[model samples]
Target: MSTPTSSSSSSIWVLSNIKLQFFARIRRFLQSKATRKRCEPSDRFDTAKNKTEPDNKVENFETVQVTEKHKEKEEEEEEEESVIMMQRTVKMLHFGSWEEKEVAVKEIEKLAKEDVKVRKLITELGVVPVLVSMAVSPVNSRRQAGLTALIHLADGTYTNKALIVEAGILSKLPNTIDLVDESTTSKLAELLLSLSSLANTQFPLASLDFLPLLRNILETGSRSFDTKQCCLGALYNLSTVLENAGPLVSSGVVPFLLEVSSVKEVSEKALATLGNLSVTLMGKKAMENSSMVPERFIEILSWEDKPKCQELSVYILMILAHQSSLQRKKMAEAGIVHVLLEVVLLGSPLAQKRAMKLLQWFKDERQTRVGPHSGPQTPRFAMGSPVNQIEAKEGKKLMKSLVKQSLHRNMEIITQRANAAGESSKLKSLIISTSSKSLPY
Candidate 1:
């Protein structure tokens, strides 16, 4: 019933509205799909970037760890190289030209001074035998270098000293001692002294004809002071063993020591060696027979600058005093009692004790001589008893003379000590009072 134009217009309006709504829906759907694609790719890219970041961090951590390990390995290699270098230096001591050998030995000496480990290494490398060979070489410079190296090597631990001894250095050293110059001889003697410090080394040394060599060196006036000191030191060390005592006495060491007993440089050591030698019975007898022994001991005992010598000389005299009655008589006749009494008053405590013991022994001996005897008895009322009186008178005279001489000697010493120490009045009064009241005679 409506008009046709109005209806048509209404139908067209409805169609246009439907078309616009449908197109808007289609455009919105397409735009959502495009946004979804873009967001998915962005999420994948962010995920890949996160994964790559950790991998890079792990790679950096591994690089740092690997670098530290590499550095540690380098340090180890360097330490090993140093040890190898030290070993090569030791080995270079042999199988070289004279100059090269000299250089090698000096280098070894340098290493030897490093520490005990290097010294033991040098010993184990069998360098000692080659050094011994080089020590006896014809070239003076090489010989000196070899001896110097041995000196340093032997200055190590006991194992090092034994290594040198086992190397047959004792046998080779005696012959070379005479052929070398004074400097080399001194070094050799020093080496020997070091070797002799260990126990049981002296026997082989003596058997290797070293005793005579040492005696010759000591007796030679032309030797260096260091050589003489070293020789005396060696002898002193060797004579400490009781078995070597007799051999030393018989090998003319006693005479040589006595001859050099006055040498200021070696006198103390010489007296010490003699004291060691006198520790045995055979040595005691030898010393008792030597007139020079008591005389030298007395001289040393009176020295003001050498208190050690005084103590040692007193010790030797005490030993000799205990040997036999005849020896005691000889010591007393040699005017030893006054010296012993003086030392009892003025010497060190040990010396004082020894001097007192000897004096007591002398007193006991005198008492025994004058005491009643259990043997066959003689009547005291005999007319010829004048003989005993005369003998007693002579003994008193001898005793008085000894005491006077001792007093005079002590006064001189006291005066010297007082003047040196600026204590003249106090010491002189003290000595005067003590000597007056303390004379046992």
Candidate 2:
């Protein structure tokens, strides 16, 4: 009986301890689960919201959104404001008082310069016609303001430029440019420069009003060279059209160009126009008529520092000299051959090439020269001549021989230079192998 009671009591104690350990393990698992849940965002929000049960628990159901679409709304607002401003500007430009019109045009000019799109846009508002009309306004300040606006409107857009011409700016020009001051004259010249591109198309830029105004400004010694350069640019553009040549020459542009091209400041532009005119019959004839032709041009060719001027001058001479004996004789008498030799020695490559070609013509003239000869002629022998015919002829032949040899030597030097320039062997040999006979004359 005693052994049974002791065994039963021991078993009961062991069962109670096992139950307590199992409950502790369950409690540890539950604590770990609670810690992990609290680490989540929703659980943290719930814990922070309220210590009062489910009533104070937080749940946010508001739908969230990114608000970047406001830019489209802002652009729409800007567009509306721009339209209102343009309408106001156009109204003020069209029917406003002189002061209002002046203000409007300046605004147009400023707007046009901002963007090409703005230029095209403002042009659609009919600002060009009003600006052009104001260009001819008798009031000098109004005129300058108008011209300034048009120049900006016509800046880089071809369509805007075309619209300006189509607005009859040509017809509206004041007959007397002298009525305007130098500042207004300069502005007008700049406008013409911008509008000169119309000459390249079918548009008629050679109206009676156009060339006269250009000539007036260009001829005025009081006008600055900057203004003159702008006028020259206009003249050059107009001269590009073949039909404009007759009127250009008839306008007495040749004499003025000859006078101005001598000045180094405007020489290149004036010469370039002369080069264009030289291609036309009237232009060639007009230049030939000028006492300044080969002499003025020959003087210009000596400008080594002004290489482009030299090039243009030589180009005009080439045109004038081709198949024209009268001009060539005048050139020879005016000491053109010496100039050509100088050009051959010291000039741009294109200048050198052109000079050599002109020289070849003179050389051919020398080789085939008969009674009244070519190259550069010496003084003639009278009937009772001091120079005996045999002696003179022999001396002439010997001098020709020396010249020929000197030409051969100079050509050899040129070949050596070509060699040093890293030219191809075939070209080098072609130059090197050339005999004196192969030289001009």
Candidate 3:
């Protein structure tokens, strides 16, 4: 009995100790679960924050692309609008009333100035013909507006120039140019000048029957200064066409040009046209037949106002003097030798050179005529006597003085060339020696 009681007590004590250890383990596990639950929210918050930043960046990138697309769309719309406006303006130019046409033309001129597309569009719409009609309108204001519009259109575009020419504008130019009013003629001349610039248009212009009208206005002296200038400019431009050279000379262009060559405003252009006309054989013959004399050209050479005019006048004279003893003798009588000497002393370098060449030509020709071996000879009166020897001696003295002057002038130019050549030779030698020393050999 005592052994059984002892075993039962031992069992009871072991069960209590086992229950206490189980409770302690359960408390520790609960504490760990609570700590993990608390930390989970903070960790998830950090992950969500990181994901939101990239999402924001991606959204911003998409927004930028969308903005660019919108900008492009807006620009395209504006360009389309501008094209539509231009097309509308071009249409209005055709069917509009006089007042409406005037308004439309004014607008057309403005648009034409801003863009080449507008000019091409106006031309394609056949507005140039209408403009030409209005250019000759009975109403002065309408006529002026039409001319002004045409001028702007032909300002820089060859297409517009061609369109204007093709619209029968050249056919009407003669009649319109004959208008008695100074203002009318001025504008007409301006248009003629513009049309004459193109190679293809030049023939049509030359074929016109208005050369007499142009000459009349230029010579009449009744036209305003500006009108005369415009007419002069048109003639100058027309004279550039070689085919027109004959008609220009026949229409009295040479005499009028000579008459106006003294006017400072027109002198340069007048001389230039005469110079161009003299290039053609036909033109030279016509000029020689005209009332204008060679003495006028010699006088021009002496003018101190314009050096270029003097230079060009000398050049034209040089061209005329070739192969024409009559012209040469006339020039010599006009004191051309003295004038050339003055040029060599005081004119521009180019003028000086030309003058010297011409002088040398004269000298050579004199030597050829007199026979190179024959020294200066005495002139005989009707009888081969010494009565005219004094006259002959004076002529010889004059000839010697001219030769001496020419030699002195040529020596100065030759010395300059020699010095320049010597310097260049020294420079070349220095360069060669320097290069030679730099080479390995």
Find the candidate with the highest lDDT and give its number. Answer: 2
RMSD of each: 30.3, 28.0, 31.5
Per-candidate TM-scores read 0.69, 0.70, 0.66
The weakest ten consecutive residues by lDDT in model 2 span 60-69
Kindly list the per-residue Cα lDDT of model 2 for residues 41-122, writing each as its tens digit.
4445556556654542322311111122244346555755665566677778876899999888877877777998778767
Pick the TM-score winner.
2
- Using lDDT as the yardstick, the better of models 2 and 3 is 2
- lDDT (Cα atoms) of all candidates against the true structure: 0.70, 0.76, 0.69
Which residue runs does candidate 1 get wrong by more than 4 Å?
1-80, 94-98, 175-178, 200-208, 323-325, 361-441
Candidate 1 has its poorest 10 consecutive residues by lDDT at: 370-379
lDDT of 2: 0.76
| Model 1 clashes, total count | 0
Candidate 2 Cα errors over 4 Å, as ranges: 1-72, 202-208, 366-441
Model 3 pairs whose backbones collide: none
